[model samples]
Every structure is written in C-alpha cells, then in structure tokens.
Target: MIVVERTFTVTATPGAVLGYLQDFANAQEWDPSARRTSRVGSGPIAPGAHWRHIRKMWGVTTELTYTLIAAEPDRLIFHGRSESATCTDLVVLHPVPGGTEVTYRMELELHGLAQLATPLLRGEFEKLATGGVTAVTAALDDLSRPAGLRRRLGAATPNRLPTPAEETGI
Candidate 1:
C-alpha cells in the first residue's frame, strides 16, 4: 500500500471549494492521470453517487469505478476499485482566514497478481500520484489567482486540455 496526502489553501470560499470538489468529474480538469472522468450514476451529489475514470499511469491506461462512500459539509470519502487495485480518497475542507484549506489523502493497495508486482511499481505509482496532485494544486491556484495576475503565469498548456476525440474515446 502507498499513502500520500497534501494540504493547500485556495482563495475560494469553503462553500465554493466544497461544491467544486464534490463533482468527481472535475478530475478531468485538474488531474493529469485522469484522462477522463464522467458521472456514471447521478441524481444528486451524495453518498452512493458514482463516477468512472479512465486514468493513465506509467504509460498504461485503465478504468476505475469510484463511488462516494461518505459525504458531509466539510468532508468526503470515495472508494475506487479497478481489477487489480483499490484506492480510497479522503478530502477534508475547512474555512480559513482568507479562503479554504483543502486536505486530500489517497491510499492505494494492490490485489491479486498485482500484489506481487508492488515493489516494481511503487516508484511509478508515487510519481504519478504526486504529479496528479501537483496538477490539481496548480489548477486550484490558477483559479484562485486574481485575474490580472493570472496572465503573468505565462502561456497555457496546450496538451493539458484533451481534444474532442480523446474526450469521447475515454
């Protein structure tokens, strides 16, 4: 098993941050590893809502089905399962002086034959997860930046946004 977590402050209200984070599909907008994420079963945002993600890591792509296991005003928990692995993601939000403090924690465990390969794959898993979370941090930072200051961040990343075909394919 591998566990990684990060905490960051965003210049958005706790309500705003909660709303944004509640939608798992938003991962496509922020997480590099998530090639695509879409709601699989949805009526309202609550426990039991499901999302599907086509995630790419270490040059290979696989699908994971994630279900919200817990939801509250300030916290959320999701359980994701693929054929070879299961991951749990916990997100906690709190109001701060200026904005919101976001804490994200993820735990990944290998199962079946994949367990035997964990040693060989741990480095890549760590790298991929770190990069994805970093992307999420950068995205939230960009959104929170004052509009006038954002342009100074330089050119937009082209490939970061998937093309129409990629979106549909995933």
Candidate 2:
C-alpha cells in the first residue's frame, strides 16, 4: 500500500473547486496521466456515480472503474478498482482568505505479485501525485478567471483574476 497526500491553495471558492472535482470524468482536463475519462452512466453527479478512467504510466496503459463513494459540499471521496490494484482518492476543500485550500489524498493497494514491487514504485507514485496536484491547481485557477483575461493569458493557461478586495483596495 502506498499513500500520497498533497495540499495546495487555489484562487477559487470551495464550492467552485468541489463542483469542478465532483465529476470524475473531468480528470482528463487536469491529469497528465489520464488518456481518457468518461462517465459510465450519467444523470446527476452524486454518490454512486461511476466513471471509466484510462491512464498511461511508464508506457503502460491501464483502465480503472471509479465509483463515487461520498459527496459533500466541501469534500469528495472516490474508490477505483483495476485488475492489479485498488485506489482511493479523497479531496477536501476549505475556505481561505484569498480563495480555497485543497487537500488531495490518494492510496493505492497492489494485489498478487505486484505488491512485491511496492517499494520500487513508491518514488514514481510520489512524482505522479505531485504533478497531478499541480495540474489540478492550475486548471482551477485558470477556470476561475473571466473569459477576456483567460484569452489574454493564453489558451492553455488562463489568468487568475484578483479578488474584489484587491480591486477596491479595501
């Protein structure tokens, strides 16, 4: 079993962060490892929703079925399963002065013969987890900006707008 937890702050409200993350299919937008992610059966996004996520790592592609295990205004928990491993992802959001603070935790449990390689794979997993969190923060910060600012910043990375206090010098 390997676990990676990271915390970052974004220029968006807790509600905005949660709304963007609640839909697991959106992983493709922020996760560099994700080849594709899609909702298995779509209606409302809530507990019990499912997503099919395909990710490529170290030149090997793997597919996992992820289920939404818990949902709240400020937190979300998901469980994923594949042939060789099981994964749990937990995301928590907190209100902050400028925006929101996000804590993301991921746990991976390898089965069968793969468990033996856990030590060797720990470093790689840590790298991926750090990169994933950075990407998520970038995506959310970009999405929080207005269209005009986003366009000027760049199509790839939108600019984050200043808060009302900053604008009024309050």
Candidate 3:
C-alpha cells in the first residue's frame, strides 16, 4: 500500500472550504486528474452517497465509483474502486487562526500486474500526488484572493482573485 497526503492553508473558512469540497460536481474545478464527476445518488452527500468520476492517468482514461463511507461538516472519507486498484481518500478541514487547513490523503492498493510494478508505480504515484497537492494549493490560493485584484490584473494578475479551477490547473 502507498499513501500520500498534503495540506494547505487558505484564507477561506472551514465552512467555505468544506462547502466547495463537498460538491462532487466541483471536482473538475480543482482536481486536475478528474475529467468529470457525476452524482449517482439522490440528495445531499453523506454516508452511503455514491458518485462516479472519470480520471485521466498515464494517457489513459479510467472510470471509478466512490462511496462516501463517513462524512462530517468538515471532514469526508470515501473509498474508490476500479478494475486494477482500490483506494481511500480522506479530506479534512480544520479551522486555524487566520483561516482553514485543508488536507487530502489517499491510500492505494494495487493488484495483479500493478503490484508487480509497485516500485516504478510508486515513483509515478509520488509525482502525481505532489502535482495534485501543488494544484490544490494553487486553487485555494486563488479562491482566497480578492476579486477586484483578479479583475484588474487579468492574465498577468499575481495572486489576485483566482477560481479554484484556475489555481489547480484543472
């Protein structure tokens, strides 16, 4: 098994961060690996709620289904399964002195041929995980900026208002 975790501090409140993270549809706006997300269950997300997402990896596309196993106002835990692997993602939001601390962690288990290539695969996973963390950090930074600055600076804008999508390069 391999695990990767990253955290970022954002000016947004925990509530705000949780609100954005809880919206499965918004995954495209922040998670670069996600091509699209579709809800599979009715009503608001909670334990037992399910969703499907198509992700791109290694120039190939794969679809996975995730079931929410646990959920709190500021934390979410889910497991995802695909033909080759299974993984758990934990998202946590904590209130801090100035804002919120958002953390994302993933634990993965590879099977069959994937397990045979664990060493090489782990390196790739690390690169992907690091890239993901960087993207999340960028997204949060953008979301926390001022709107006026974003509009005024346009493409050249430095740290002005940034949409989660723009920040994460999703």
Candidate 4:
C-alpha cells in the first residue's frame, strides 16, 4: 500500500470550502491529474454518490469508479476501485484564522498484475500525490482573488448579476 497526505490553508471559510470540495465532479476543474469526471447518477449527493473519473498519471490515463463512502460538513471520504487498484481518499476541513485548513490523504493498494510493477508505479504515484493538493490550492487562490483584480488582470469576466434589461431581453 502507498499513502500520501497534504495539508494547506485557503482563504475560504470551512463551510464554503467543504461545499465546493464535496462536489467530486469539480475535480476535473481543479485537479491536474484528473482529466474528466462525470456524475454517475442523479439525485443529491450523499454517502453513496458515485462518479466516474478519468485521471492521467505516469503518462497513462485510466478510469475509476468512485463511491462516496462518508460525507459530512467538514469531512468526506471516497473509495475508488478499478481492475488492478483500490484508492481510498479522505478530506478533512478545519476552521482557521482567515480561511479553512484542508487535509487530504489518499491510500492506494495494488492487486493482481499491478502488484508486480509496484516499484515503478510508486514513484509515479508519488509525483501525482505530491502535486494534487497544490493544484487545489492554486484553484482556490484564483477563486478567492478579488473580482476587480481578476477583471483587471484579464483572467476573469466581471462576476455580477445580469442587468434587468438583459434579464428582460430588452
């Protein structure tokens, strides 16, 4: 088994940060290793929420089915399984001075033929694990930046409610 962990603080309240992170589909938007993610079924997310994720690491892209094994306002856990590997992911959030402190960890277990290449795989997996949380931190930084600064930097469009005229198609 291989395990990786990371912790960081972001400029968002715990409630807000957990709300965003709980949407596993957002992994595609914020996680560099995640190439795509799609919800598997309709309904509110709960302990059984499922998602299909396509992730690339070590120059190989693979698909996995992830099930939300646990969910809470400040914690979330997911179990992902593929033909040759199982991954357990845990996320914990804590309130902090200016934002939330997030702890993310993942454990990977290899099986069958994959076990034979564990040495090579561990090295690559370490790379992915090391960089994963940093990707999330970068995303939060972008999201937490002031709107005016984002617009002036030409990185984002103005975030505002639509004008009444536009809303009314005038």
- TM per model? 0.78, 0.85, 0.76, 0.80
- Give every collision pair in model 2: none
Error of 3 at 89 (Å): 0.5
- Considering every candidate listed, which one attains the maximal lDDT? 2
Candidate 1 residue-wise lDDT, 95-153, digit = tens: 99988889999898989987897887777766766776666666666667677776332
Q: State the lDDT of candidate 2 residue by residue for 65-87, as single tens digits.
A: 89999999888999999998999
What lDDT tens digits, residue by residue, belong to model 4 across residues 1-170? 88878889998777767776776876776566777677777788788988888788768887888899998888999999999889999999988898889999989898998888878877776777666667677666555667665422112322222444766999
Give the runs in model 4 whose Cα sits over 4 Å from its true position: 143-170
Task: Return the lDDT, model 4, position 153.
Answer: 18
- Candidate closest to the true structure, highest TM-score: 2
Stretches of candidate 3 exceeding 4 Å from the true structure: 141-170
Clashes of 1: 0
Off by over 4 Å in 2: 151-170
Ranking by TM-score: 2, 4, 1, 3
Candidate 3 residue-pair clash tally: 0
lDDT of 3 by residue, 1-170 (tens): 88888887887777767766675555555566777676674786778877777778778787778788987878988888888789899999889998889888989887787777667767777787777766656655566678664322112312122344765999
Clashing residue pairs for model 3: none
